[model samples]
Target: MAASKIAIYGAIGANVAIAVTKFVVAGITGSSAMLSEGIHSAVDTFNGVLLLVGIRLSQRPATAEHPFGHGKELYFWSLIVAVLIFGLGGGVSFYEGIQHIRHPEPMRDATWNYVVLGLAALFEGTSFFIALREFRREARGRPFWQALDQSKDPTTYTVLAEDSAALAGLGVAALGIWASHRFDMPALDGAASVVIGLLLAGVAVLLISQARGLLIGEGIRPETARAIRSLAMQQPSVQDVGRVLSMYIGANEVLAIVDVNFKDGTATGEAADAIAAIEQQVRARFPMIRRLFIEASEAPVDAAATA
Candidate 1:
């Protein structure tokens, strides 16, 4: 199966288990942080399912109403997931935290909180490890931040981000629990919930920013664009390669528009042949390019060289 799917499934399973355990413990101990953690895990679980559904929807073939295929479906759903995280997870946690702070309740049976948190940490840590390893494999030799920025496939990155946030939130929750128990300040538990909510909100904002770029048709990497331009210039009858615009239509799928300056006074038949040759070479060289549109024009400088 796809790496994204595997990661999603793993996260869903781990989060579901964690969420159930956390809710049970929260009910038993009345720890505000535990309840917040439960909500966070539940949101992560639902987000995983949404991502899977988005992937499936994105695989649909092109139709008259949507000629670019359903590839953008994934981006749309990803945005929705971000909104949900912010609205449902972060917003609710913040409200609960404030309520707890105003009317602080004594935490009972604190031992169960530790047991549940330890188990949750184990499960969240495993999921995070899987996501990090998969992301590392994808990054190859590129810097982790660079690879993350350039990745057109949002699945792995989204999962990685979610799991990373989960681990961090778990730490905060643990710390809050410990502080409250040691200092006999139950308000610390509520403060920890507030922190978790803020953390989730930050993650949601990052996801929204990434998804917005994808939705607005972000261009291909500079290196890939340059390679495509070089490929176009290799055509026999081509005089210069002009602007070559490209955008990702799906994970590993690109649509390119090549503007070419043909040799002056070239015959129509020869230009046609050159265009065909350019298309063939481009598709052959970059299989990820699902569609190519070549336009032959009059005198024009190579935009790439000037840039």
Candidate 2:
């Protein structure tokens, strides 16, 4: 979470400064691509704020009405951020590009656009590296795509995705600006804006998919579940392990319920002790399992039926 905060803060600061500069340059040069980039940065800044709000809200304590706490708040806000990117960012950029293409206006000198773009690249690049570093650290030694697929925390990856899109948008904007000046064709700049809009829309769709999955209650990986089942089976009083159900209640919190069948003659006291021991061992191995429920069941009719 600390890493998430650092990445988001860096992004917000960089985007705020770059958005202002891009808008100023766009105003002076009347460059459609630059204006679109400005809108992108502004939208990113606001998205960063929404992420922060999500993080804060997700930290709220669990209550009677909400037994799982407010952890899903982060996923909810992440979805909203993706929607805003698609709407305010991508929609506006696409519209602006079409308008510019229809009413092609000659651009002013390209010197300021180049200078501003260079600075924007530097700032945006720094933020991107920061986010990538944090994400990689969290991923440990896992493959990038695999780690991303299993990640429960939305803030870290969301920033990484946004920065990645921002960097790509910058490249597109730079190329479009150069092409317009070199060919003396202003419509190319609008074309660049269109490309950027499509890029953002693509990123938003991916983000929405991920956030939606988490918001609806994603579970731990199959490997983790199998490991946990094995751990439960290792208990002497346990005859077999049945269902091992798990769900992520927060970024670092998990709630798991396991059905264990005990030996037919096992005393209730012995079952209780075994359950306590099992809980301790599981929690020791996977500290993220904040809440665990172990249900004792009758001996399985089919001993081969295991989780």
Candidate 3:
């Protein structure tokens, strides 16, 4: 299976189990943080399902109305996931925390909370480790942060980010429960929920920014763009290379347009041959470039016009 699918499946299984256990434990122990964690897990489970749906829809063939295929469906669903995280996970947690703060109550039988928390951590941690490994595989030689910025597949990175936050939230919940009992201050539990809410909001904002960029047709990496321009400039009949426009149509698919000016008195036949050779060479060099359009011009094309 694809990395995205693997990450989503692992997360869905872990979250569904964790959410059920946490909700039951929350009801038994009446721990605000536990309840918040349950809500978070539930939302994550639904998000995973949505991501799978996105993957399916994104695979649909291009239609007359949409020549570019349904690849952007993945971005659209990812944006929805971010909004749901902010609204359902973050908003609910904040509200619950405030309510608990205004009317604090002593947690009953905290032992069960600890047990459930420990088990939840185990499951969540496993899923997080899987996501991290998949992300590392995608990163390869690049630094993790740089790879994340360059990544076109939103599903994998979104899962990694969510899992990272989930692990952090679990730690906060454990601390809050311990401190509330150790210090005889019940307010700490609510504070933990608020902290978890803030963490989720931060993740959501980051995801929204990434999804928006993808939806708006983010260009290829600068290095890739430069390489493409160089490929065009290397053509024998080309006098000068003009604007080279490149955009990612999908994770592994790129669309590039090369504008070139031929040398003075270059025959039409020679220009055509050069254009074909350039196209073939570019595609051969970068297999990800699925579509290449070469335009022969008498004069160097305007950069501003291309932009």
**Which residue pairs overlap in candidate 3's backbone?**
none
Clashes of 2: 0
Pairs in clash, predicted candidate 2: none
* Most lDDT-accurate candidate: 2
Question: How would you encode candidate 3's per-residue C-alpha lDDT over 1-307 as one tens digit per residue?
Answer: 2887998999999999999999999999889999999999999999999999999998899999989788878889999999999999999998898888888989887898899889988998999889878888877789988888778888998898888889899999999999988888888899999998988998999999988888888877778878877887887778888877877777667788888888876766667778888888888988878878888778443445555
Task: Order candidates by TM-score, high to low.
Answer: 2, 3, 1
Model 3 weakest lDDT span, ten residues long: 298-307
The TM-score obtained by model 2 is: 0.94
What do the candidate models score in CA lDDT, each in turn? Answer: 0.87, 0.91, 0.87
Best by TM-score: 2
Writing each residue's lDDT as its tens digit, candidate 2 over 109-136 gives: 7889999989999999999999989989
* Model 2 misplaced regions, further than 4 Å: 299-307
Least well predicted 10-residue stretch by lDDT in candidate 1: 298-307
Question: Which of 1 and 2 is the better model by TM-score?
Answer: 2
Candidate 1: which stretches are off by over 4 Å?
A: 299-307
TM-score of 1: 0.91
Alpha-carbon RMSD, each predicted model: 5.0, 4.2, 4.8
What are the models' TM-scores?
0.91, 0.94, 0.93
